[model samples]
Target: MAEKEWGRLPEPPREVVLRVKRYDPERGRTWWQEYRVPTYRGMTVLDALLWVKENADPSLSMRYSCRMGVCGSCGVVVNGVPRLACQTQIAAVASRENPVVTVEPLHNHPVVRDLVTDFTAFFEKHRRIIPHIVRRDMREVEEAEYEFLMTPDEHLSIYQYSLCIMCGLCYSACPVAASDPEYLGPQALAQAYRFIVDVRDEGYDRRIAIVDTEHGCHRCHFAATCSAVCPKDVDPAAAIQRLRRIVFLRRLGLWRKRKVAPLAGPLEKPLRRIRAEYPRHNLVEGADPERQAREPVDIDFREEWLRE
Candidate 1:
């Protein structure tokens, strides 16, 4: 254990001040505690906390798993900005000279302990939206009927919102959520949009009653901060805007739900399925059946579908 025996470590660990906020619910008090953590290259903020818990202070508490960013459990406020602790590099927010990183719990949620916040309310709001595909037919939902199909364009519309990991960083960054807990907030609204426009989902109308309420989509001020802080790159603000537009369009008389051409109709299959099974009508939704009826032998079912 001689100093010289450990020949000048190629990447010497540097000391950084971790100014962590400590809160005790029983005592009803909060305080900042500082620890000097040896930060090396590629070390994350979560790594620093873990190191302190192991070597420095055993009582130091924080919640994390997957050490990778996917679990969404390591969200914390670093230097006044909410971000995932596992993904934030310590050096990126702290330096050798001014090596102080202020770590606190996420803003909006009630703190469970040192760095863990109670996600009950956030999850309740999420659940209130019924974040799932809703089908009108009870038999089809309970048992398999046919494959739920979607075009690539339809997939693209909701895919971005679907990427949300429910990290709550968006909730932390939202001014509305911080001030008014009643608001459905960006996270819930964006997820509602994920199901709303989905071709395979039939629950849009049901969710509309919830999202169009007082503390719902209307309350968002388009601050765009939610999208900015999202770790998943899901643009929640844009989704809310699109949701508002859809509500307004439906209010007026445009944009009715497209008639679903039944699979059991005259054309035993959709033109796209036929083309995929046969050859090229090669297009988005396979060139609307009504628009082209060039040949009487074309096996068109527009007349039948349109009548319904």
Candidate 2:
């Protein structure tokens, strides 16, 4: 018997119109340019652009370092949706009435050439938050006497945020970034939360003021448009909301007192055993109430804070 393949590719009349937005800074002009490229199975938007650049238009330009979605460089607005060019397939964006999927530089950022946009403002916002682990005990942190250890649950808290490639899709999708250049956009805000939740990072006190400002988490209207368009499932809107909760809880003095962050090495407790305890307010007033007498309480911060 002959060996059989599980799948076969579609026959080649797979052609689509790639309408790209172009800009020439020197001539001070911008326009829509179209190209008809023969698509194949697994052909991405980046792949289509490469085929055009190699076969059709050498003048066309875009920035893409890793063809895979690692480097976070090839961010563009496709079909009015912000996404990673290399990750979006031609077949995915193609449709009957609008067979022509549009490609353009990120809307909020200044276009450098054709498909590339300037990241100066994007990176500056990232830097403003001081996105790094900071500890007052310089000796323990800098000398690496011991490593800060975290439970599996603790690590998972911010793991989704660490996946952000800083592709700027969220920033482009945000109406806030476009109108207020000084606003710390969703990408940086998400990153701020990534470290803020980490057991290893002690930078919360240092970073809180930066994110608690008028241009910070307070500015997010919870439209969640940033979360909707993020290629990486980093829920920036949720992060901002959590930041607000942290700040508000602190002001009310209801935040659970955290134990000193644990340090693990050859001689230390296991990570899971090192977790800080939950707030006392969450616990029932009576201990082990008669078999079925106890019921879970619905605790609200506003209500609890006013309680004596």
Candidate 3:
């Protein structure tokens, strides 16, 4: 059989159909508009929107600045998920065959235009937490003379929670924000926990007091969706749990007060027997026999194996 020669094939251009939710202040009714764009290989959703604004329609309004994820300005609901448009690729998110991308303004906020949502309420809640390091004392000293050194473990403990960019994605996704305007939401409560857990912070009691009420930490139902959708991986759910512990401990008078109460006659008999049989030394050494055996075996094995 004779081999047939194949001709060069043309490159497949990227394209996607975007359903944008548009609203104008002048026009009270909000409507959806569809636009198809020839997408590039590495084109982002923000790029597609910008292309539509420049080439297709000039009046299309959207908010974007850095064109990167850091700015937290280009956040919009993409396919019901709160995402930063600049960071999401159209090819990755949009269906290849259908390619119908739904773009809408973030929920729980007033829509400004096509993709811009007002962040006044978001900032107001953020500012209410006083997201700044409250010093224990204002005593001034030389940098060399006075230094607060922290352990590596201590620094890393709070490092993950410190990555929040205030993007308001979690705030928009929160159900509490929709029902109650003064709920303080996840972001604010997460920030409250950041300061509350700081060992150097003296305002732990004050910060806890702010969020201990009905509209605060107590309001969280432990849905854990806030942590799941967080771009920075700041587990606001864990912070809420820690806050609960703090609140419980505070209410129980476990913070500084120690209460001495006599044990019941029946309880005291068993406890005395346990204390007499185990003793302080035996308790300190631990009750795990396997663990004790493994320690000596591990030392012998390491010495023998290395020598061999």
Candidate 4:
């Protein structure tokens, strides 16, 4: 008995323009170059690029491995937003009027070639955070049988943050890094929070102190670009806010008191006034809050001490 046949798959539409940023070390110049590619039905931006590189121009250079977003190798600035080319659909972004998707290397990093950037600084910052578990005490021989146990609630607290794929999108989109390169940036700061909030880590206080510095959590301005462009929905901005709250509470000894400041102007106004008057009344510097609260702190001494 013969079975009835279903309809065949439809052919992909003919051509799409790939506008790429081209740079050659030998030539010492960079320019945009366009290539018209014969794209398939489910073709992605990465596929189109590969097609152009293989057939149209062998000199063209780009980075890719799995042809998937997992490797984070093909992340580039597409139309001003950092996205993985493999995950971006060509049909959706390419247009006849615009008909060209501008592809450039990831920002805030040294460009190696046409689409690849040097990731040494990015990974170096990650390494500086010391992302690891620190055990408090040696477990006894019998106690060693049980691994560190975490509650469901505790796991839920940091579960979203642990999903970071380190695609460098957050780093590229970060305005803080552009203005102040010393700032730790979102991905690294979020990872710091991941460890600081973990119940199993013994060095939570140390980690908090690490992030409380000028280049750490305090540098974040609460801009939500890191959260918005994150492909995995890991809200680094929210994590940073949590870390800032933790730092603020720790400085004020409110963590033990279990009290959070009200959202109204009572607390914020005084703090802002003190900040304006003192300019250098960071809690870490042993600034006397009572003195500052009573009268404006001397900024000259604070600045001299900070320089020291």
Candidate 5:
């Protein structure tokens, strides 16, 4: 038997009007531009937008690196809902009666162009949360001694929050973000909770201090809009609420502390000896072994500052 095509739409290619909110910086104006395009089976919003750019207007501007939903670059407001264009099928959103599909730049962001929005502030908020592992001992972290291991249950605890692609969709749909400029936003707060629950992390005090301010996780009112619009189902609203509860419980001396993951001891055997199938080369023919053995150089400023 032949393999069934899952993405195939029942109907054939049909004409649909793509209404885009276009912004021209040079003209200092924004307007709606419509284009009639043919939509085929398995066609996505991203494909439709690409068709519009290629056939209707070549001057259209947008940011999309990986055409899949993993990059989170093609996030836009479709019919007032924030979604990833690459993941949203045209047939799912459009109908026979209403053949118009409206595409606009994500809300709560400065419009860079027709469909591009500036992510400078969005990334800055994410950076404020310090979205990385933080340990109490800097020397243990820097030395290539042993790896900190977490149990299966502990890893799954923070795995959901770690799926955030920084798409800004949740931020766009957040009511608090719309009203408050200084709010850390759902994306940052969700990440704050991600590392907070990690068994290997020890920067809870520092991170909590940053997020306990006036415009921090406390500002979130549990609207749940962020969770509804998230493509990855990160449930940022729940994370924020949990974050607030953690702060409250800690203040009241009711917070329960869990044991951190233990570090691995010295290896009994060489890595290759333990795992015989481990790749010896860089997956390339005639690759230099010395160059491959060299560790990647990266700047880590967390150890430079004195503990508070």
Candidate 6:
């Protein structure tokens, strides 16, 4: 099979140096390898990496899928910033005169090899937020059901967040994630807000209970880097801020979960369902009653949830 052309041939390709950070778990070693790669007018970082892997070194490793930006698989640190390699043009990071494109694995993630970072923990944090719609009628969810109707205005409200590809770029650029390993990170928190505000979703009480804790949305220090580095232009920092306000209001007994959006039906209107509640555990499980009483579990939210 013929090799596919990488980028536009508007201009002649130039020789650019690609300085890649390499790691070998088998040898437990880390090093840098520089390769001179041919670049074109619209050649991307991923294109250069492919060229290197095919021509210069077959052992060179990196992750990429769907040369387009949809899959979010080619996330890497391009000269100290988390970016989608497929979306980043080579001209943006390198020049013919000073031609050097430094590539490395994302920060705050465990490196698997050369440029691949382990997403096990990152995905685990995402799963803990319960990134799915929660409706009271388990039967409706499990069995066949009518579509949940939503207006254009309602759809537009949460449309931006729906664009998240779970690329982990926000999590990699998050300063809070760098400091606290337990922090839920921006991607998860943004996704939490996405489902919370989604008119079709009814998972507010259940999700809020999970993200209202210290290691959850509260850990975000509002660095805004997560928003800055997002390839899809999703503002996770803004979502975190809004989530914080909602959490505060819920604690102060000022806000309540809104009713679920209506289902498409000509016979009857969708019934309002009671919010699903989950307990917030402040004390360690199996701790002595005396120790639980003596120790101060400093939870920021009030015990208003306990009253219900």
Q: After superposition, how far is residue 219 of candidate 4 from its true place, in Å?
A: 1.4
Q: Ten-residue segment with the worst summed lDDT in candidate 3?
A: 1-10
TM-scores for every candidate against the unseen true structure: 0.79, 0.80, 0.75, 0.75, 0.84, 0.81
Worst 10 residues of 2 by lDDT: 1-10
Candidate 2 vs candidate 4, lDDT winner: 2
Instruction: Give candidate 6's TM-score.
Output: 0.81
lDDT of each: 0.81, 0.81, 0.74, 0.77, 0.85, 0.84
Question: What would the per-residue lDDT of candidate 1 be over residues 95-157, giving only the tens digit for each residue?
Answer: 656889999999999998899899999999999999876778755556755666666787898
What is the overall TM-score of model 1 with all chains considered together? 0.79
Among these predictions, the greatest TM-score belongs to: 5
Clashing pairs in 2: none
- Give candidate 6 misplaced runs (Cα > 4 Å): 1-13, 266-308
How does model 4 fare in lDDT? 0.77
Error of 3 at 190 (Å): 0.6
Per-residue lDDT of candidate 5, residues 1-308 (tens digit): 01134456455338889899999999989999999989897788899999988988998888787988899999999888989999887887787888889999999999999999999999999999888878788666787488988888988889899999999999999998898978999999999998888888888878888999889988999999999888888999899999999888877878755776668877554333121133574577776656645743333333323233
How many clashes in each candidate? 0, 0, 1, 1, 0, 0
Per-residue lDDT over 90-208 for candidate 3, one digit per residue giving the tens place of the 0 to 100 score = 76566566688899998888887778889998888778776765544634122223444456676676787888888788878888777887788888898888877665455676777
lDDT (0-100) at residue 203 of candidate 2?
78
* Candidate with more favorable, higher lDDT: 3 or 5: 5
Give stretches of model 3 more than 4 Å off: 1-13, 139-147, 256-308
- Poorly placed runs, candidate 2 (over 4 Å): 1-13, 268-308
Q: Candidate 1 — what's its lDDT?
A: 0.81
What local lDDT score does residue 261 receive in model 4, on the 0 to 100 scale?
19
lDDT of 2 by residue, 157-247 (tens): 8788998888998999998887888889998988887777777777787677788888988888888889988877888989888877887
Sorted on lDDT, best first, the list reads: 5, 6, 1, 2, 4, 3
